[model samples]
Target chain A: MNDYHNRRGFLKKSAITTLASLVGTKIMFAENIPARVTPLPLLSDSVDGKDPEMTVLSDRPMNMEAPAHLLDDPVTPINKMFIRNNGLPPVKESIDRSAWTLTIDGESVKQKRTYTISELKQRFKPHTYQLVLECGGNGRSGYYPPASGNQWSQGAVHCAAWTGIRLKDILADVGLKDNAVYIGYYGKDIHLSRDAKKVVISRGVPIKKALEDETLIAWAVNGDDIPLFHGAPLRLVIGGWPASVSGKWLHTISVRNIVHDGPKMGGSSYRVPVIPVQPGEKVEETEENFRIIESMPVKSLITHPKSGAVLSSNRSLSVRGHAWAGDLEVTEVNVSIDYGCTWQKANLSAPKNRLAWQQWSAKIDFPQNGYYEIWVKATDSKGVSQPMVMPQWNPKGYLNNACHRIAVKVVV
Target chain B: MNVRRVTLAVAAFFVIAMGITCVSDLRNDQTTTDTTATTSLVDTLNYDPHSGLVVDTTLGLVVANCSGCHSTELIRKSRFTRDGWIAKIRWMQKEQNLWDLGKNEKSILDYLEKYYSPSSLDARAQMRREPLDDIQWYDYQ
Candidate 1:
C-alpha cells in the first residue's frame, strides 16, 4: 500500500514540473539579445597602457585623444600622445621583433625589396626629429552642425621626438622608378570583421612628401620603444600633415605610378570641398569638386595654468602654450584678455626642428578682480592666422582652427 | 480487482487537486505571461540601463543593427538631421559593409530622426557665455 502511494506521488510532481517549466521558459527566453553586442570599455592599464586622463573615443579599434592641459610638456611623452587605430593591433604574442620585416613593392618600384628591422637599423643611419602630428579633425567639436567620427576637441595634436631611419633613405635604396607618383602603406592591423582579405585603412602621400627628410619609418618615440597603443613595432611618421598619413603597425609600403587608390585615399576621406560650402549645405561631392588636404592649417593651444585657473590680482599671471603651423613656422602668437579689443604679443620660441611646434609665453597683470577669458591666436609663416570663429564649414568638419580660449578668475 | 480499481480513481482525484495548488505557488513571482498587457515592462524588464537609449518598441531593432559595430555612446553623442543620418548610413553601407536594412529601414530612420536630430539648443546665440559682469571672486592665497 505504501509503495503504491509513493509511485502515485512521484507521477503527480513530475506532471506539475512539466507544466511549470513550459510557462517559465516563455518568460525567460522572451528577450532576444544578439550575439555581437557592443564592446564594453574594459581597458585595464596593462591593455591600453594610456594615462587615465585620456578621453576614449572608441574601444574596439581603440582611439583616444589627449586633454589640452596634459599636453603642456615641450616634448609630448609617450603616455600623453594620442592614439588613433583603424584596426585591431596585432596580437601581443604575434609582434615578434625578430620576425618582423618591411617589404617595398609596387608598380613603380625598380625592384621590390624586403628588410628585417635589424637589417634596416644596421644598414641605415638613425636620425631623430621632434615632429608635430595633428589630426585633421582636431577641433571638430567647434563646428555648429556637428561632424561625424571621433568628435575630437583640441588635443589630437602632439609634438614627439621620433628616432628612426629616414623614409627617403629607404626609397633611395629600393631604387624607385621615375614614374613613382605616390607611396601607399600597408599595416598588420586586423580588420574589425576579422576578414583576412579586407584592409582597414591604407592611405599614402605623394612621392615628394614621402621623400622629405622629416618623413621617418620610426621605431621609437622619446628614446623608448613605441607604446603598443601608439603602434610600437614600426610606424611611419609623416609630420605636419594629418596624423592618419603616418600609418601605424607598418609592414609594407608600395610605390605606385598613379595616385595610390588605397581604401581611404579616394572619396572625401581627407579631401575638402574645392569650393567652400555654407554651413549645413549638402553637395554631391566629386573629384573635381573636392581636393585632398595636404598641409594642415595654423593652430594654437593655451596649456599653462589650465582653464578655470584661479589667480590673485596682486601677482602677475604667467601664461604659456604650444603652437604649430602645418608646414610653416608660427611667426606670431597674440593673447587677448579683454575679448579682441587689444592684443598683446607673447614671447615665442623657434621650433626644435623643422616641423616641430613652437612654444610661447606671456606675463599679464589684472587691474581688478573678476572673470576673464584668455584667447590666443597664432599666425603662420604665410599671412594666414587662426580665425576667432569657426572657419569655413566642411562636410567632414576638418581643420576647425578657431582660437583656443580658457577661463580665468582673478581675486583681489 | 474491484477494490484496487476503486483506490486508483480516488488517488487520481487527489493528485489533480495537488497539481493545481503547485501551479498557483509558481505564479506568485510573475505578474502576467501576456506580452500585450498594458503594464509597462520596459522600465523594469525591456530596458538596458547602460546605454540609456530611449526605451521604445524599436529600441531592440536599433541595438541589434547599430550596436554590433560601435558603442551606443557614439550614437548618443551624435546629433543629426534625418538627411545627415541617411548620409551616414549610406557611407557606412558603402565603406563599412553595413548590411542593407531592407524592410526595416523606415522604422529605423523614424526612430533615429525622432531621438537623434539636432534641436534649438545648438544655436550659437544660446551657447555663448554671458559677459563677466556679475562677479564673485574666490580668495586665493
Candidate 2:
C-alpha cells in the first residue's frame, strides 16, 4: 500500500514539473520571436585567451575594455590594457623589425630624416616614465541617447612605465623649422578594404605638447618589447593627452605649419563641445561649436569591496582605488560612506611621474548591518573635482568624470 | 488495443506541432523576401563568422566591398538614417579612398537602411535600461 502511494506522488510531481517546463518554454519562444530572427555572429565567442570578464564591443576592429574590478592595480599589465584599434593590425609575419624605419618630414622640417629602430636606440638617450594612456571615450556608455562609437565603460585607461627615446630629441635632430606649429604621426596599418585609403589612423599634437619631456617614441612597455597588438616595432607615447595623439605602429612624423588633417582629425571624431551643453541635446557639428579634446578631466574609481559586495558589519572595511587627471596632479581623494552625507579624506600616494595615476585608500567602519554606498571624488591640483553626476554630453561622448559610486551590503 | 490508441494520438500531436512550426518559418521567410528582394542579387547565404555579417542577398556585396579594408563591426556598430548612410559612403569615397560602388550602391543602401536603421524604439529602450549603477567601481587599497 505504501509503495502504491509513493509511486502516485512521484508521478504527480513529475507531471507538474513537465507542465511548468512546457509553459516556460512557450513564454521564452514568444518573447524571442522577431520579424526575421537573423543570426548575427557573437564576437566574444570566437576570440581565444581573452579575459572572459572583459567586455568585447566588437571583434573585427578588436575593441575591448577591461572590467573595472579587474583594473585594480596601480600599473595595468599588458594583457589588461584596453585594446582600441581603429583598423586591423598589420600582419605579424610581415613585420621586419630590422628593416623598419621612421621618417621625419613636412613643410616645417628643415630636412627629411629617417631612423631605424636600432639606430634610434644607439643615437638617442633612452628615458623611462610611468604614464597613463586613456581613451578619450573612456566613459562613453554613460552618455545619454548613446554616442556613435565604441561604448566604453571605465576600464579604457591604463597606467604603465614606458621605455623610449624622447620625441623632442628626435625632432631636434631632424631640425624643426620656426613655422612648425603642429606635429602629425602616420602608421603602417592599412585600410581593410583594398579600395579604401592607405592611412588608417594619423593624429598629432601641438608643437609645445610634442616637445614635452614626457612625450616619447616608445619601443618597449613595462621593460619589455611592446606586444604586436599594442604596436610591435614602435609607437608613440604622448603622456596626459588622448591616446589617439600617440599613434601605434608609428612610421612617420610630419611637422606642419597648420593642424594636421588626418583620417580621424576632422568631422567631430575626437573633438568635444567648446562649451558645456545640456545632456542629450542635439547640436550641429561645426568648427566653431566644437574643439579637439586634449587633456582628460580629473577622475577616480573605487576598486575595493566591489559594488554589490557583501561584508561583515562588525569589521572595518578598507576602500582603495586609483585617481588621475590629465596634465595635472591628483591632489586629494575624498570618500563618503553615507551617500555623500559625510566625507573622509583618503590617503593619496605620489605618482611615479607627472602623468601617472596616484593610488588612494581609506578605512571606514559600518555603523550597522544594512545597505551602504561609498562615493569617491578626486580633486586635481587645479582644484577641479569630479562632478557628482555625468558632465555635459557631447557628440562623441568624451571626458565623463563623474564620482565613482559603490553599493555594498553589510550582514551580521 | 489501448497501447495502439495512445501511440496514434501522440503521432497526431507531433504532426500538428510540426505543421505549425513550418508555417511560422515560411511566414518569416516571406517577410524577408518581400523587403530585401527589390534587388535581383538577393540569395540565401550561410552565416560567415569571420566578418560577423549575415551571408544574405546584399551581405555578399557588403563583404566583398567593405570587409577587405576594415572589420564588419565598423558597419554593424553604426546606425544612421538613409541620408546619413549615403553621406558616409560619399565621405569614404572622397576622403578614405573607397571605390565607386557603381550600380551596387542602391542595393547596398537599401539593405543597410532596412537591416541597420537608427536605433528602433525597442532597441533604444533596451539600451537605456542597461543599468549603469551596477558598474563595478575600482579604487586603490
Candidate 3:
C-alpha cells in the first residue's frame, strides 16, 4: 500500500515537471520578472583575441544575440554601432581633466614619467584609425562549466575610429631598454575593496611588437571624445592584437624583462585544454607547459537578415556581416546558403584598415522557404579559418572561434 | 533636541556603511575544489548579501565536476544527455583536472544525472514571464 502511494505521488510531480520543461525555463523567468527590472545583461559578442584594442562585431552590440547584427547601409552609425569593454566601466564620468595622469616607466633607459590627457594630445599629433576594441572574454559566457568570472553575456565589445598618439613615439622618447621582454600596462580602476585580489587584470606584448607604428595611445572614438564605458580620456590601441593585451582606461605602462605575472597573468585563468574535449568537458594541461594568450584567431558572422529573420521571396537578399582575425589579416570570407554543406566567397567591403573588422557581403537568391541556415567562415591571410568547433574548452573562457550559424524561417 | 538626535543617527549610519564597504573585498577564503582544478578565488571569497552567484545545485555538480581546468560556460549553453554528461565528466576528471569526487559530490552528480538524464529535450520552459516583453525583445536569437 505504501509503495503504491509513493509511485502515485512520483507520477504526479513528474507530470508537472514535463509541462514546465516544454514551456522553456528561460521563457518562464521572463514571464515572472517585472517589466521595470532589467534581466540578464549578458556579454553580447565574441572577439578576436589578438587585438586588445579592437571591438566586438555584429552591427548592433547593444545585446548578445549572434547571427551578426545587420545594417541596411554599409556604415554602422556611431551611436547604433556596437560597444564593448573589459573589466568594470570607469566609475567617474568626467574624471578630473587636471587630475588624470599617464605614467611611462620600467625597462626604459630614462626614468618613469607621468603626463595628463591634455599633455598627451598637446605633445603629439593624434593619429586616427577606425579600429575595433574587443574583450578576450568577449564570448566568455559561452564557456563550458560556467567559469566564475563576470557572467558576461555577449555585448562586452565595440568598434570605432580610435584617435591618439603613436605608442612607438612614446616608447622611442624613453628609448627601449635592450632587456625588456614585455610591455605591461594598468588602468585607473581601483576595486571598491582595497584587499580584493584581481584575476589577470594586466596583459603584455613582446617588446619587439611595440616598435610598430600602428600602435597608439588613443583618446577619441569616431570623432567624439570616448564616452566613459568606452574608456574615456585615453586608452591603448595595439594594432593586430587581443583587447586584453591592449589595455583600456590605461594610466601606467611598464617595459619589463620578465613575463607579467599576477592573478591575471601567468595563471590557469587563460589556459586552453591540452587536447580537444567534448563540449563542457574539462581539458587539462598535459606534459607540455601552458601556452601564453596572444592574438585573435580568424572568425566571421552573418549580419544581415539577423538569424531567424523572415525573408521576402526572391528579394535579392544582400547577405552582409563582419569578419576579424588577430595580428593576421582576413584573406577571404565564405558564406554558406545551404548550411555548412557548401560555401561561397564574399566580397569584403572597403579595407577599413586591417586593425578593424572589414565588412563583407554576398548577394544570395532567396528561394522558396523552409528553415534555412546561414554559415560564414573567415580565413586570415595566414590561412587560418574559423572552425565549426573550438579545439577544446577551458575554465576561464579564452579564445572561441567556431563558425557562427544562423537559422532563418520562411513564410508565404 | 530632536534635530541633534537625527544628526547623530545619520552620522552613525554613514560610519557603519563606510566600514563595511571598506573591508568587504578583503575576504579571500581559499577553498579549492579539485574537480574543476579550480581554486575558490575571488567569487567564492567575495560573498555579498546581494550577489546572485550561487551555483544551481544540480548544475553546480556538473559544473564543479567540469571546471577542473575549464569553466562552466560550456554546461550552461549546451543545447547534453545523461551519458553525455557522464561521458564528459569522466573525460574532464580523467583527462582533464576535474576533481575526483567525494561523498558529497554524488549529491550534485545525482541531481544532474536525474535532470540532464538524457532525452533531446531543451529545458527552455517558460517558468517565469519576460520582464521587458512589454518593451519589446532586446534583440538577438
Candidate 4:
C-alpha cells in the first residue's frame, strides 16, 4: 500500500467522460503490419513447432465446458503459448529488423549506453528462468456485465522458460545512480492523439521490481527467437506483474526520480482500485478511486483430461496446470472437487526462480463424473491465497482471481 | 490588456486552439495515419524487416471487414492469429447481430494477416547479427 494514496480528484472519472473529450487524436495506433502466408484458416491454429501440453488454448477456446490444464515444463514453448491481445495481431517482417537499440538512462544508472539484442545476449551471461506471464485483464469477462476493454475470457496467462539477460546484469553494467528511485520503460507501440500529436506509451516499474534477478530483458523464448505475437526482438519480462505494463516490443529503459506518468501510466490505462470494491459493482471514481495495476494474484488452473472429459476407467487421474504468484513464490496449492467445499493441497514443483510460476501436479479419483467441477487455489509464500469469490469490479477490470473451475464427465 | 480584455483573450486562445486541434484530431480519431511515428512503432514492435506492415491488399480487406463498425485499433490490439479473428467474426455475427457476408470474411482476414501478424523474433538477437555495442541511441530516435 506504500506510494498509493494519490487519488486526489477521483470522482467524475468515467470512460464516457473521457471518451466524450477523447485524448490524442486517432493518428495511427501504428503504421500497420501487412499479413502474409495467408489464404488459410480464420483463427491462427498454426502454433507450428510448439509443444501441445502447454498450449491447449492457443488455437481454440479452453474448451470452456471441458477440463484444461497447464503443462509441467518450466519454459513455455512458442507454439503452446497463450496470447490475449486487446486488438489486431501485428505482423513481423524480416526486413523490419533494422537493428534497433535499448538505452538504459533512468535516474539510477550512470553513463547510460545502448545495446543491440545480440550485444545484450553476448555482453551479459544469458540467464534462463521459468515464470508465468498473465495478462492484467485475465479472467476479466467474469466481471459481470463486462467491465469494458479487451473483454478477455480466461486464456490470458502462460508459463514459460524465459531466457535473457537479467535486469540486475544490465543495471550493474549501467551503474545505478544514488537518486534513482524508479525505472521507467517505453515500448514501440505508437498511437496518435486526436490532437495530431504522436504519443508513445511509457510505463514504469518500481526500483524494487526492476532490481530483481528474475526480471529479464528477454530476446528469446523456448531456446529459439521469441515470436512476434509474443514480445519479439526484445521485451521487458517482469517476473510477477500485470502483462499490459510489461510493454511488448519494448524500446527504452529510463531510471527516474518518480513514477513514469505517461498516458499509459497515469492518464490512459492500467488504472485500478488500490483496494477491492464489492463484486458486481462498477467502480465510480466519484465513490471509489482506482490505482495503477501491478503484480498478479496467486492463481492456478486445471489442464488435464479437459473439463467434461469422459475417461473410460474410474481410476485416479493426474491433475496438472500452472500455479503462480507474480514475483512471489507459491508455497502451496489447493484443489477442490466439490467447488470449494473440501480442498486437497496440490504438489507444487517450482522452476528456477521464486518470481516465476511453478508447474503443479496432483492426483484425484472421481467416484462419479457427471458434470463435475474441479477448482484450484494457490497460496504465496507471503501467505496470500486466491479467494473463492471476487469482492467486486473496477474501471479497468483488473485482478480477477476467482477459483478456476473445470467441468469433466466420466463414462464407464 | 485590461482584466476583461485579458480574460477574453485567454478564452479566445482556448477556443482557437481547440478548433485547430479539433480538425486534425477528428481525422486521426477516425483512422490511424501512416507516418514516421507509426512506422517507427511498427519497426520497433516488429522483429524482422517489418515489410509486411506496409499498407497493401490485405490491409484493404481488413478495413472493409473488421473496421465496418469499429476502428482498426479494435482489431489492431488483438494478438490472436487468423483463427482467432475468425472466432471473433463468428461471435460478432452470431452473438452481436453481425451479418455474414458469405465469403468476404476470408479476404478481410487475409488482409489482416498481412498487416497485423505478430512478429516472431528471438528473445535475444543472434551473436553474429549483433549490431554495434557502442552506446547508440534508443530507436526512440
Clashes of each: 0, 15, 79, 89
Question: In model 2, what lDDT does residue A59 have?
Answer: 59
TM-score of chain A of each: 0.88, 0.87, 0.76, 0.77
Of candidate 4 chain A, the 10-residue stretch with the lowest lDDT total is: A1-10
Candidate 3, position A11, lDDT: 19
Q: lDDT (0-100) at residue B55 of candidate 3?
A: 30
Which regions of candidate 1 are displaced past 4 Å? A1-47, A313-315, B1-47, B125-141
For candidate 2, the per-residue lDDT at A8 reads 10
lDDT (10s digit) by residue, model 2, range A141-216 = 6666556688787888888889999999999999988999899999877565543456888999999999999999
Q: Model 4 segments beyond 4 Å from truth?
A: A1-40, A44-74, A85-91, A94-98, A190-197, A279-288, B1-141
Q: Evaluate model 3: give its TM-score.
A: 0.63
Candidate number that wins on TM-score, 1 or 3:
1
What TM-score would each prediction reach against the true structure?
A: 0.81, 0.75, 0.63, 0.62
In model 2, which runs have C-alpha deviations exceeding 4 angstroms? A1-50, A195-197, A279-282, A313-315, B1-141
User: For model 2, what is the error of residue A375's alpha carbon versus the real structure, in angstroms, after optimal superposition?
Assistant: 2.6
lDDT of 3 by residue, A52-154 (tens): 1122222111222221353223333444443443344455754765678889888554677787888887887878876645556655544444443343433
Lowest lDDT 10-mer window, candidate 4 chain B?
B132-141
What tens-digit string does per-residue lDDT give for candidate 1 at A326-395? 9899999999998889999999999999999999999977768887888999999988999887788888
lDDT per residue as tens, model 4, A122-212: 7899888776777777765455433445545455677677778888788889888778777777665423222224334567688888888
Q: Write the per-residue lDDT of candidate 1 for residues B1-141, one digit (tens) a residue.
A: 001122234444444454344323222222111111112221122223444354457877888888766666567557788888898889878767788999888898887775566642244324332232212223443
Comparison by DockQ, 1 against 4, better one: 1
Residues B1-141 of candidate 3: C-alpha lDDT, one tens digit per residue: 000122234444543454345334344432211111011111232221111122333444444454443333333233244555565667546533456677745675555453233221211122111111111222222
As a whole number from 0 to 100, the lDDT of residue A329 in candidate 4 is 78
Candidate 3 wrong stretches, greater than 4 Å: A1-67, A70-87, A140-157, A192-200, A273-288, B1-141
Predicted structure with the largest DockQ when compared to the true one: 2
**lDDT for position B139 in model 2:** 29
